[model samples]
Target: MHYESPVREPLVIGDKTYHDITRDVARPIETTAPKMWWIAFSIAMAMFLWGVGGILWTIANGIGSWGLNKTVGWAWDITNFVWWVGIGHAGTLISAVLLLFRQKWRMSINRSAEAMTIFSVIQAALFPVIHMGRVWLAYFVLPIPNQFGSLWVNFNSPLLWDVFALSTYLSVSTVFWYVGLIPDFAMIRDRAVNPIQKHIYKILSFGWGGKVKHWQRFEEVSLVLAGLATPLVLSVHTIVSMDFATSVIPGWHTTIFPPYFVAGAIFSGFAMVQTLLIITRKLFNLEDYITIQHIEMMNIIIMLTGSIVGVAYITELFIAWYSGVEYEQYAFLNRATGPYWWAYWSMMTCNVFSPQFMWSKKLRTNLIFTFIISIVVNIGMWFERFVIIVTSLHRDYLPSSWSMFSPTAVDIAFFLGSIGFFFVLFLLYARTFPVIAQAELKTILKSSGEKHKKHHSDDNHGHH
Candidate 1:
């Protein structure tokens, strides 16, 4: 007599097998491009071109081409810079922090999340260079010794720390992303029928072969990198927050900034992940692999981080009022009722109020509502940065210097263009690579599918 294995809920549905995982994940890469892919790619390219035009015009005419003025020198450019950087944080959290915690569900999404991290950081890095006005001499921020007086970067300055932090984050993320792709690249190399495709994948795979030793080394290396990246996921944003916190500006100076910024980063980053994955799962017919369960789990994270961000908002208000510092008090009061009141309220509504919907299971699980709220969360996060930067800078202690900032056509173009750039990279990645981790998914097959359990039972009975 044979005993049955206990039934479990499937993470990868549609009764998928290990072979099915490989075929489904690799199909997008090996097959011809779909019409929708081309249409999307075309739109992204157009936006990228517009961004290029904006950058070139700025370089030619100087920073004056932007809406920046004396009262608000750091306007749209820095706001966009911080927004992109924050958006990258969710990828690191999903990949590194989740991995450390032994979360198996992350295997399906970590590949694309890491890719998003690298691309978003690239977009974030652009703003600082272009904002320099004299783009060629931007390297002056580095600590390299120079002929003129052996000038060195300021160690105590947060701005200098940003240069180092960003560079380090980009380098580590790129290496981590590429290392994870090697196994999948080898799988693709084995599957390729065309000589050119086979050769390309061979180089990309770095001669990876599925030996026991190779698998052992892969696991060890992944664990080590994940450990390293976990701290960075926290530190990078903390340093970014320091850019504001260290400043004497009333609205910007606060003790709650480090944790607050980190929470907001994860909030925005998860929203972006949802926005991309919802479209991807639909377009690629990957409903079985990237299931509703995955979507719901991500929404839960967004809700958690969104709540933390909301608390940070209220804390800032309370701290300002409690301190009785007139400057700090006015900063909070002005944020809610000043000329930029609309932006502030928009941030409050989207970040604080919208996420409250997730308390209902029905709303969290509903795809359309989740998608819409995810977008709203990102918009709110962006406005949160804008409000922090602009409102803090626009008004001075000497009321005579108080002024408002309005974005120019170039500023608008660059911001919209950056969105296009991000999407363009993502679309290309979806078509050219395994968006899901096929090998990792195979490892969990026995635990996730009825077919795997039945197969295991048959093998056990035969041995008996």
Candidate 2:
């Protein structure tokens, strides 16, 4: 009797086999970095350095350097923080939620998505630190014994909850991402030509060998981590929303913020993923692995989440009018027709209206349209945060304190710099890391490719 490996369609395109999957993923890391990667990296580094200068200038000149006033204490800084946090949520969704659902398509994109999550969160973490005016004494927010006195941090504060939630999320996501990379790192280590490359990957892989027991443990550990990460996805954003929902401000105090924010997070997260992957697939020549089918499915998610977010916007308006509270009613009214109405409309147009384009199959699958809308979605999400934070606070109870908030050059610099910082990390990651999960892709190749189907058909005909 002869033993035969199961024959099926390839998951990887370009007629790739399992060995090819390993070779393709490990190629960037094993070989010299691409010229395009370096060009993008240089641009990103310049932006990052520009942002660093802005941070240093702000610290030296004090918070007064930014356009923040007493009436609008929280402006671009908090808005960017929320935006980055929301962007990070999709990564957790792709890694944890999709994993639990046993969605095989996620395997191609989840590795990079998880990396995006970690890097975006790092960018988000910078905001609260910089916004603190006295960032040097930032440890005071932690529940530690202080030298000044036993002044305990406020346990009841949502801001403190943010501290806990963001920290836990970053830590778990790092562990989750590193764990997923171990097998791929081992693949790279095995094929490495340079002694330094081999040693680095070996250390990173934790000596992973292709033993049956090792495979079993890897799957078990992945499942356990996914289980742990699932609830954090919901909780992290909910806690962030509580920073507003728990407030007494008319627009901020709402019962619907948790689910609304989570939907928006996934919406924005998927858009960012699409934006990154579309560029990635084209740049690295991995169309077979990251297919149009994957892009279409993600667009569908964007449309669904965008609709949910739109409905949430309407629900907030209805609830405000129904409550008959002058403050709440005026808050919603101000958002639509007041001084900052432009921001509100921008959110509506980009988020609610733009995603509707995806309902058309041709548009959803069109790479250019998907990329454009992905960017639009992020822009809209940023406006959503701005409208929520600044618009709500700009005109409060006392009309005497009414004032318009605008971002300074420093504010704009910091935000743009954060973008540079995020891409800088991501570009480096793309060059050095396995962007696709080789081990996971191998498992699905039989079911994914056209060649496998042809092989199966041939085998069945021969048996007949």
Candidate 3:
């Protein structure tokens, strides 16, 4: 029953045994820090500290330190917020949705993808909190008792919905990720040589006994969580799109936003996964586990989502023109031809045209080409958010209310600092956690492993 087609490339190459997997995954954690890890860690730490300094500067100086005028109030912070949230979408999709559909390919990459989701969502959560001029008053966004004077939260607002949606997402994703890590934690617990290490992992593993009933319950719980999480994969991004779709802004007011945002989120999310996994496999020497097949599978997703995003872009333009609404048409036109036209074209070229390169089988499988394209796609996705937020607001119906927007040094700092912060978390996770879900990977070895497949073929030949 466990037979993979001959045409299907092996998921795990190098004829790896189960022991080899445990050894490879544990090596980075058990061994002393490698030179490259230190180099990468030092650079990431510097970036994180710089960003922390920027965050402190903003807190001290107030929102005035940021580049916000009356007309273009929501700029870089909101843009980055949406961008980070979009990046988190791929993790849930890979873990929850793929799990529901019974995709075995997810086994190798889900751990890192889920970690990326949790970290990126952390970054996303920070923006809205900081965007509030008084971070102390952030509790006002939540619905609390009337004892606190009259700071009632508006139930109708998408902003309020964002608070609810994002929190739920972060909570569910964290739980899902941790639940899946239990068995892996137990594996490390058993392997730990040091008493302290053993005690730490033993507690983390929750005294998992690997009993028949324990595994039975584990499988049921994973399925239940996956089922619960599957809808969130769609709902989270749909709600995120509502932040714009529910708006009256010309470019922002569109029915297509929910699906459009969802697709764009997956598009950018997959690209980020590619970016991280490429570096991870190389750094950890996990080529046998995270293979070209994995890379190609991810690329194929990036292409599909990228193409959907391209169509959405075209649909937006056509809708703007066809709606006979001058304001809508002007919004799209200004994006392509106004002061921030560079941003618009960058989005187009990077999000739309760059992914088209993946149409070639040779290119999608090419690691260097995939890495470069991955970066390009993320850059394009960032520009896409910028153009949408900045362009739509810069020129409104009333000429007197119209004004341009630019970022202060603080704006740049917060953005770059977030990147550093994200990597700092991921690098730590890479070192400490099993980057690949080794337990789940073992399930696929008999069917999709190169050596196992050859053995099965020989047995068939002998029988015949």
Runs of candidate 2 with Cα error greater than 4 angstroms are 1-11, 457-464
What's model 3's TM-score? 0.98
TM-score for every candidate vs. truth? 0.96, 0.96, 0.98
Among residues 3 or more apart in sequence or in different chains, the pairs in candidate 1 whose N, CA or C atoms overlap within 3 Å are none
Write out the backbone clash pairs for model 3.
none
lDDT of 3 by residue, 133-212 (tens): 78877888889976668768998998888888999999999999998898888899999999998999899999877899
lDDT by residue (54-91, candidate 2, tens digit) is 89999999999999999998989999999999999999
Residue 217, candidate 2: C-alpha displacement in angstroms: 1.3
Error of 1 at 277 (Å): 0.3
Instruction: Write the residue-wise lDDT of candidate 1 on 281-384 in tens digits.
Output: 98888888888888889999998999999999999999999999999999999999999999999999999899989988999889999999999999999999
RMSD in Å for candidate 3, one decimal? Answer: 1.3
